[model samples]
Target: MKNTRIKNIIFDLGDVILNIDVPVASQSFAELSGREQSEILAIFNENEIFRQFETGSMDEAGFRNFIREILEFDDLSDEAIDTAWNSLLLDLPPERVELLKNLGTQYRLFLLSNTSSIHITQVNKILEASTGVKKLQDLFETVFLSYEMGVMKPDPLIYQKVLAQAGIKADETLFLDDNYDNIQAAAKLGIEVIHVQKPTTILEYLKDYAV
Candidate 1:
């Protein structure tokens, strides 16, 4: 079942292996800030601060301060803000864990995600609670995070960095992501890519190789 050409596999985190609902987090923030959910969603999608936070240009404290300033709620505690921000992260299904474990045996697995520290903390907690995994690093050879690398997906540099760091050839690696842009970017770099579209998950896409 193994693909001889692909010696390495790079996975995207949100909506691929882990479930995420942006609207859910927006609704939670809406409740806390007394703003419409749409407004919160719009800000998340359009705001530069969110991207900056993910790329490590803004620290957690700075992000929280910006949240207070924008939401006009200086009294909001850090815990409350974090809860609202992390509410989007739903769960990591057991099936996905099994799939990754099985794939790890036949391929060098890696995780490359555009994410922030706060979300990753919640992701680890969720992973441990659901799959008994203490950390995501246990499931992959190397975990490349945007915050740590100061670069994100769809940027050629990030993909190049991953290939260099892992010592994997582009044509010999397969990249799976829910984002079309990310998939195309990887493809343009000569890496095999699968656009893990909605209604079709990574588990289903790689069913042939799973277990």
Candidate 2:
């Protein structure tokens, strides 16, 4: 039932490739906001400021300002904000990077991530520091950031855009994401999906895929 003709692969960034600890970020925000982590996370869950930043409606400076206004942390320095915002980002293991680099030669690789500028800055630092690989973009045919695309995952537009831009049929492409909602969205559009989970790494899961 698998599509052997699949020529393109779309990958998600956080949790799938890079580790993210949301609790660490929540704790950082709670300390800054003088609120419980639960309250801060609740606000984050419903916050338009976050959506706007991720969708490129706001830049890093604007996002910092919005955080100050929303969290009532008027004294929060830009450095502090960037640090706390990037708290959730963890290491990008060298193995993952090697796998991606190898896969690039065998398939058309693409990266799709819902992220902000501050986080991306840290992500790049981690990648370079961990593997001396300065950029993942070099391995990808094209990298699609939600911020750059002005649309986040689970949205039809982002999926449609990638498919159209790559000139690939949805059924002939595979998408890998950590979030079920994101996978579901792409699946609805006819893309094959692998729900990348914690116990299984991307490389392990794809060992038999398209082989």
Return the TM-score for each candidate structure: 0.95, 0.94
RMSD of 1: 1.5
Where does model 2 exceed 4 Å of error?
A: 1-3, 209-211
Q: What lDDT is obtained when candidate 2 is compared to the true structure?
A: 0.87
CA lDDT of each candidate?
0.91, 0.87
lDDT digits (tens) for residues 48-147 of candidate 2: 7668999999999898898888887799999988888899998898988888877777788999999987888889889999999887676688989999
How do the residues 105-133 of candidate 1 rate in per-residue lDDT, one tens digit apiece?
A: 98999999999999999999999999998
**TM accuracy, model 1:** 0.95
